[model samples]
Target: MQTSLNHYSQNNEIHKDIPGRKEIIGYGLGDFGYVLIWTLVASFLTYFYTDVAGIAAGAVGTLMLFVRLWDGVSDIGMGILVDRTNSKHGKARPYLIWMPIPLAITTVFLFTVPDVGMTGKITYAAITYSLFILLYTAVSIPFKTLLGMMTQEQHTRSMIGIVGAFFIQSSALLVNMITEPMASGIGGQLGWVMTGTLFGVLAVVTLYITFRTTKERVGFVPTAKQEEKVKLSSGVKALFKNKYWMIITLFCISYYTLLGFVGAELYFAKYILGNASYFSIISLVKAVPGILAIFFMAPIVKKIGKRNMVLIGILSIILSTFIKYLDPTSLNYFLIGSAFNGFGKGIFGAMLYALINDTVEYGEWKSKVRTGGLVNSAASFGMKVGTGLGTAIVGWLLAFGGYVGNLSQQSDTALQMILYLNIHIPFLIAIIMFLLMWLYKLDKIYPQIVEELQRRKNE
Candidate 1:
């Protein structure tokens, strides 16, 4: 290990290779696979559990809250595992190669509701969802950590994020456009089973490409002694001490909490808007603005800085969502609000991974220990908590409002609750995110941090 460190120090020049367009596109392709699975589960899973699989709303919500809580715990464990790993394939990229097939399998199982009774079905949901979250954490933590490992240039990382957003939103749009129609056309449980299988296959292929094409630099290979000293407690301590990381983690939790509104859209469209297929239209509307936002994201972040860009984006969401709340039933108002919300989401989404990557650097600079996996894992932990809580809110709110999945049309109380979950709740969360952004000042100090790290490395 000492020899390895000396070699790395002596050959610091070897780390300067910039990723070409092919590599960048390859990296972006990984997210295409990732979001295909993620968007499907995040956006559609709750609806599938209740409306399709015949689970009660409250049960589904409670199940998700517990599963996601376990998922959060596993995320931290996966992070530490990645940090401790020293393999020929590199620290993070190996998981991309190994886990895709299992991820695909679990995805299929998640959608394949059995012919068992309610107890059986709930058990199936728990078992399958747990496995899926485990596999997802295994792959996702590594994939996210890859950003920091791939390059040290902030601009390059930002560009990778931009390209990635294009693929992520594009995959999400495709899923939105196709998932419902395919499921409905196929007639029952088999429809969802088929949809999951198709996306799962695609996920495997794209992830393999990512594993093959991307290379990891800035790799931290710990000595046995160093590894022995790297306790989970220490990693957790390092994470909390970094103010920037704490701020970003909070931002992620809030941002994703607002994003929980996506889970409610299928119900909103089916019950409130009176057309399940309208989800495709709303998704299209949202995707276009997000794609457009990607085009301007890098430049805007470079100009006003990440914090300011995020502020602008969150404010856009709050404003548009508020407008939608005033008149929730109007088609034009819904579309218009969705467009602005998508635009804002696109900008913030593009900046977010890059900002998190910055936090890894900030953490290392502050703590003198480079644990990219733990830092990114901490961020992912927050996101999982947000996702679980957000989904729970939607579930519990629907149950409280007398949502009955088997009914042709919901009661007025249920529709009103759907409206709140769809528009107003997220609007409030966006305001909280805006407040969180004010505490993040890393963008102002990042350059100095980089230069100092470089100086220390050379010395």
Candidate 2:
């Protein structure tokens, strides 16, 4: 049972805090649009660089590493900016409206290869990809920050996160299903350009819906005297002091690094499995199980808490990673392993943002400062850093394994390297994530934190 729409404020003050069907659907669509373009970059961009755009593997790896690292650092700056912003649309929601058009434009530019020589190619990629990531930070940090403002109830936030995750994975699955064949059938760079354009258009529309439907209801409003004293720097210092935020940030890094390995899975499907179409099958197996898992988690999450659910998911990931090795050549084993992996990722996708939002209350309770943007932004920084590192590592490893693009057959070393990425590395990451989740005891004390914050608000 959850509480009603009327929520409490300072001195037992009451306000209507509404996050109903419209809000949930609008919120989910935001991520659904985000992942449409995000999946294109995460799963296929590296492949596009090496195979279609004619960049060397090492160059692509180095390029992604630097750009993504900078992108992560930029998130902190964006967070700070978001905290300071005041508008009719509220702090975070305005960004949902302001940034998506440029974001959509950059999405197309990322897949477009300029007709130039090798050096020129690398330079072009660097510029466009950097712009893409920066714009992503601009929109994404603000969108995530809105989660805390929409409502104070943990269960409602979790439900929003769950619906958002469903859309995230569903969009990823859609991209995987269509991207290769669509690009292949259309032929040449034109194919990718058209696909990127379609996703970019969709991104602009869905995010606008989010901006229109959601409202900021739970942000902390300071007294006149307190407002004069509050500094952004102090809020940042508070975030670092937050032990729970640190733990979850690390967890994000590990989880996304595991996602980075996904780039190599295409190579595995192509050379090792000897079937390009297996990539689609693999995507199907992975996504369907994860999507299904999301439906069942809400009830369990309500009872046992998000931390426990994540622990269970990590264990599933670990088991799935090992299962792939049982008979590496068997497609059945890969499909089964993918099923387990997707289920775990589904749980993670549903819960990670909600958990980050929880830390906002924790931070305010501990440090007496509420930083919705900074908190979400810093955590998002960890995610992008992990994504950058993961994607870069894939490029580095593939190069080390003597991989070449558009080859009829890759070397035995390349095959071995791909296998290690798909199986060994992810297993180790799952173990690391599991340990981090074990350290998270926040769910047990979150109520006390909330109660205390409310009591303080009465002062």
Candidate 3:
């Protein structure tokens, strides 16, 4: 028989209440709220810093480095803080209520490049960027932790991943579609600020619905002797040593980096595609599979196994990316290649969190310690680091290319470098990521881990 099947275990010890379907959907919006601002930043912020705001690319990149560095350190602290929390709504959910205001303020101002001289501009960028990272930490830690309590069953967790992925990708599509054309018509600063504000408000409603309606069920229960002494440091240390977790951390870093690396297409869509409307068209093509993937993605994982699905995705990305590299000027080749890339990304993105939930269970099974907050935060920290690094590299490379936006005249070499940065880098990174993931051992081994956990519960 399947030794890892928890299909028969009693619900009480594992969890209290089954999270409602409504709660699952609503909580998704909250998670999406965090990502909406992030998507906006990713889609337009580099263009904003160098083009509209008139900031130097090198300096903007430096500011990003500091912000992500802060993000990395804060994740450790937030993980600890979550462990110490003891609210009625549960440990991780409380921060959802506390984080929205700071996120809104910092994000709005981050877009507002002041008329400071070079010195003032640098100072403005530094302060705003730092605040953005801190607030992002404050919001995202709580938001990611919600997945821990959403479902105890493996299948149920996978379903949540599907829903959440749809929202995140859909938002990304909208951001990519709007950023340039809107900027062209309304101009830069207002275009980004208005878009950010509108999306931020929408995200707030989603998060609030999640907060007011969601329930926490699967929390760590401390034993009598250990009840009072469960400190954050303990959780942090336990998370670091986890083997399954080690694989996950590496996976997230690679996966997020791969995605950001693809973001170079924003520039390609802007300049080489010959118009901003092509961005929306390409994004729509990309998003269609993303929409459909959510419904079938979970079942695909169940049938093929998670590791195999990841392998398939990695291969698809590699092939599509390389194809784009080989035939850069043909729209037919590019469109087909991009569709495959998007389809593969859609599959993987919708499913990575499901893999994370499995890792959390594996960690609990092997280590006899629970650290959901630590688990989520560490992964998120890796994502933020990747995002910051990706954007910074884009900015720095643009500076190197000497590509000046809205120029009455353009240099041939500078334009060429911009195209190269837009297309070539993402293609190369996606290839490297495929090879790295080929080394992943966790998903194939997870069924064995699941069997062990069920046996312990059954016995």
Candidate 4:
């Protein structure tokens, strides 16, 4: 009778369907807002600073590095806040409702460079950018934390993550394809201001819909004996002690660092390809493969497991990037390589959050405390560090290689550096990611962890 009861309890835990299509779609829409802001910063912010704001490349690099370090530090405080939050909408979801307007406003300010002297422009950039990152951290940390709160079923979490990836990539694609033309067509600084405003409004609407439609089903409700709040240090310690969390955190750092290669595409198109608008075609090619890859992601993950699938995807990116590096001058080769890279990116991007969500469970099962916010925040910290480093590398290298903004043609040296930044750096990062995935053994142990947690819950 006890055995039957245990089996029934396990089945009940596994089969809970509180998050259906409405919640999944709502969750996915949040990424639409996220990627709109993120892609704008990642793909165009440096360009705006250099060409429009007239900041030097070296200064831009130094500023990004400094700001992102501060940004990463701030994530810990945000994580603590999320963990301690008690609200009608739950810990993470309320941020979705309350913070989007601030986020949108800050995003607009980030793109709005004032018509001031160079020092004034730099100061303006720093202040607005810092505010934007802080607001983004408040909203994004919660949105990511929401995934773990919504469901314990790995499959359901994976589905939500995959759908989120689809939306994120789609939003990124639209931003990439249109941003240059939109900015140029509108003409000058005013054009960028308009573009930021347009997306800012969209961000507000989508985030509100996400807040309205999604429900948090699996928040940490402490037992009477465990009611005291967990210290931030304890949460951080628990996160590092979970081997899988460490692996995923390492992978995210490497993955997002590789993604920072997008920052160089505008330079590559303008200087190397000899057409500023070629970036649109490159983005379109890259995005389509990733978008199409989503259709196959779930079945592939189920068949091969997330680790193997991720490994396969990383391998594809490494190989494709190497090919692009070998013939950097050939547009056909670059496009082909980008297509493969996009496929790999699609697979990895879709599965990444699901993998992180698993680590939340692993930490909980081992530590006997749920540190979902801390775990996700730590992951965000790593990503912010990687992004900062990547952007800094590009900026510093451009300065070193003598890149000048608004020049019709670049020196051969600067063009070569753009090629290296656009291709080889990403390849190296992917190799590191591949090594990190090899160290991950969570896929083998996750079922045991889940079953054990379920058993403990029932007892």
Candidate 5:
């Protein structure tokens, strides 16, 4: 180990190559592609199920829960496939290239509801949604793993993640601003079909740019002894043993849960606030501040570290909770509160993928096997499950509160339920996320972990 440390410290080429500006921006475009579709699904799928397709909220909720959970579980298999893959384009990058068009096709299929009976519609929803999730996993896990493979250095990886988050938030902003109005303007299923198609074309283009621009600089080449120990069961066990990974996974679940229910903002805007068009305005308020906040991420993270910056972001969320509490009905108050929410999301979003990639080095150092795919897969699992539950909660609670769709006025119970979802639940989620992030101690030891991993690689 000492000899390996000396050898690695003496050589810069082994781990010190920084990606160029074009490369970084190109890599970032991948998330733009991803979030274009992802935001659409997360923000409006529930509304489509209920108002557009005429499915019962509870049934849609159940389907979302089951399908998303299954999708989360499938990430494990995809991770293993990524680890074992030996492609010319590279393990993770190949998926970015191959999966985009199919993924785009599936995205369209996911939105296209067939003219059929209720059961058939449900089945169509299930099959199409499931296929879409599977394809998303195939692309998403690799895109995530590509961050770690892009560079072993934390700073470069963070830069990549920051750029990526910009795209994610920006794409989300674009989707949020247009989807509702576009669909309404187009008037009927045709609106959604056109929106999905446009986004799909854009997704394919950006992803191909990602494939063309990004290069995998870091890869694991295990010796015979190391290879023997890095089996599937052992890799899975090693992942569980990573304390930082566990904390981040839990945090991701909580974060994505919050995101899952964010779609309910449309309902909040339409029914509770009495204007459906305000959904765009709300999204505008939330997204613009969030986009601007990303510019501060590098400096703030430098000053306080990623974990602390995230903690501060959570505090911002808590503040938004308070702001909304003052007057949930006032569009003025809601917009003000949403600005804070966007700011927090921006900070956290900038840090999240970078933080997840950091865990890979820690995992490799402790386990003696580099399992980037597996580590990221577990994180994906948490995200999917959290999103599932979050989306389901909206449905279940709305159902429980006796929600009726397409009505000019909601029952008192339903209105109150929407209020709690928008106001109270975020507060609880913020607390949980804050606590989880507080428990995260990885940043303190990350440098040492990377140094140690570098030594092992040299050995």
Candidate 6:
């Protein structure tokens, strides 16, 4: 690994060279759009479904759990599909054009309050969500894998990621800030329907921009088979073999699972703060630091390299939880700590993909196949896993607290329990994630892997 930096530094050409600057910003913003829509749903959707839309709590949890499991399994196959695609635009970009319409439609559907029986609601959520995330994987895997093919260096890729994270968080921030005001201003079912439709459109447009701006850099190697190559056995084997990849995926799984609970701040603000309007402020406050995080990302990754940045991010979040848990009953401290958690999350958020670029290089050297989309497929599943589990757990907990979603109607006992779980449980999970990361070992070998691969290519 020692000589690898010099290898790339000294030589100018390589597979999946860094993406152009315009492409970087475009992808970041585009991904942010998709993430924004989904994060809103993830953050507030359960509350929306249970409290607002009237889906039962356990049913909502169960539906999310099932759909995410399906999404996880499908991710492996989608990765294979990306590897096999032979488009003029490249492996991943066609999905960019084809996916947005479906992506947009499905996202809107997830938010729709259909007229149905209790069983019907659960079925609607499970089926629509399953379809939505499946399409999401088809789009996102390519999007994420492009990061690897976009650049070879840790710093440059991290720069792209930094920009991407900003867009994602910003999109969510925008939604968080606006959803209530927009809904309340308009009033009733029409208000919610209007808000969702607007965001849904924005989501598609942003993703379209992301697709238009970026070019697939590492595609065009001839292959014996694209579809056949991406089998479940092969994809799973490939992921597990890369010890570093497994570690990265695990950390990501845990990181986002804990972080997904961040979505519940709406519940906290509305139910606990006793003012649904404050949800808007929560969005504004948390997002300000995320924007600032973009400026600091490159330098942070540059100084510590990528893996340590992940470690640092983990530790930072863990410590922030101390403030949250210690406060226990204090809303001020919990909200304040959440902002810092957002900051820590923003830093490592995009940097992790920089590490992924290195793994893509390593995988190419070992397996002699480029599965950028497949790599992202795994990541998409991990995201879904975190998100799915976050919703499942939160909904279940909300049920425990007797949160009926209608703040106007919920019992005082239920309100207090809702507040307790919203603040404390996620905090405990954040602390566990910190300890979990201490076990990773991928950061020590970037230059080593590069040197070995280069020597073989030369020989």
Q: For model 2, how does the per-residue alpha-carbon lDDT over 1-459 read when each residue is reduced to its tens digit?
A: 123212233343222455877788799999999889988899999999998898999889989889989998899999988888878888899998899999999999998988799999999999999999999999999999998888777777778888888899999999998999999899999999999999999999999999998988876355653465348779878998999999999999999888887888888888888888799999999999889987777788888999999999999999998899998888899999999998999989889999999999999888988888899999998998899889888889889989899898998888888898899989999999999999999999987787787677676
Q: Tens digits of per-residue lDDT for model 6 on 136-253?
A: 7777777777776555555566677777777877887888888878877988657777777887788788878877888765545543443345565665667666665666676667
Candidate 1 on 1-459: residue-level lDDT in tens? Answer: 112112222234434676767888899999999889999999999999998899889999899889989999999999999988888998899999889999999999998888799999999999999999999999999999998888877667777888888898899999998999999999788999999999999999999999999988775554443456467787788888899989999998988877766979888788878888999899999999999888757666667887888888888898888778878888778889999988888877678888998998888789776788999998999999999989988999999999998699898899989999988788789888998999899888887887788787766
- Sequence-dependent TM-score of model 5: 0.95
* Clash totals in order: 0, 0, 2, 0, 0, 11
Alpha-carbon shift of residue 376 in model 3 (angstroms): 1.3
Which portions of model 1 show Cα errors greater than 4 Å? 1-15, 221-229
Model 2 TM-score on a 0 to 1 scale: 0.96
Candidate with more favorable, higher lDDT: 1 or 5? 5
Against the true structure, candidate 6 reaches a TM-score of 0.90
Model 1 vs truth, CA RMSD: 4.9
Return whichever of 1 and 2 wins on lDDT: 2
lDDT of 4 by residue, 1-459 (tens): 112112212366765745777678888898898889889889999999998878988889888888888889888789889999988788998998888899888988887788788789889988998899899999999999999888887666777777888898899998999998999999988889899888888988998999999877776565664578888778878877898888888888888878766879888878877787988998988889889878767766766778888888898898888778777877888888888888888887788888988998899899987888888888888888888888888899999889888888788788878988988778778889999999988877888888898798777
lDDT tens readout by residue for model 3, 67-94: 8768888886787678668877778777
Better candidate number, 5 or 6, judged by TM-score? 5
**Which structure among the candidates has the greatest lDDT?**
2
**Residue 79 in model 2: shift from native, Å?**
0.3
Query: What's the TM-score of every candidate structure?
Result: 0.95, 0.96, 0.89, 0.96, 0.95, 0.90
Error of 4 at 95 (Å): 0.2
Task: State residue 137's C-alpha deviation in candidate 4, in Å.
Answer: 0.4
Each prediction's whole-model lDDT (CA): 0.86, 0.87, 0.70, 0.84, 0.86, 0.70
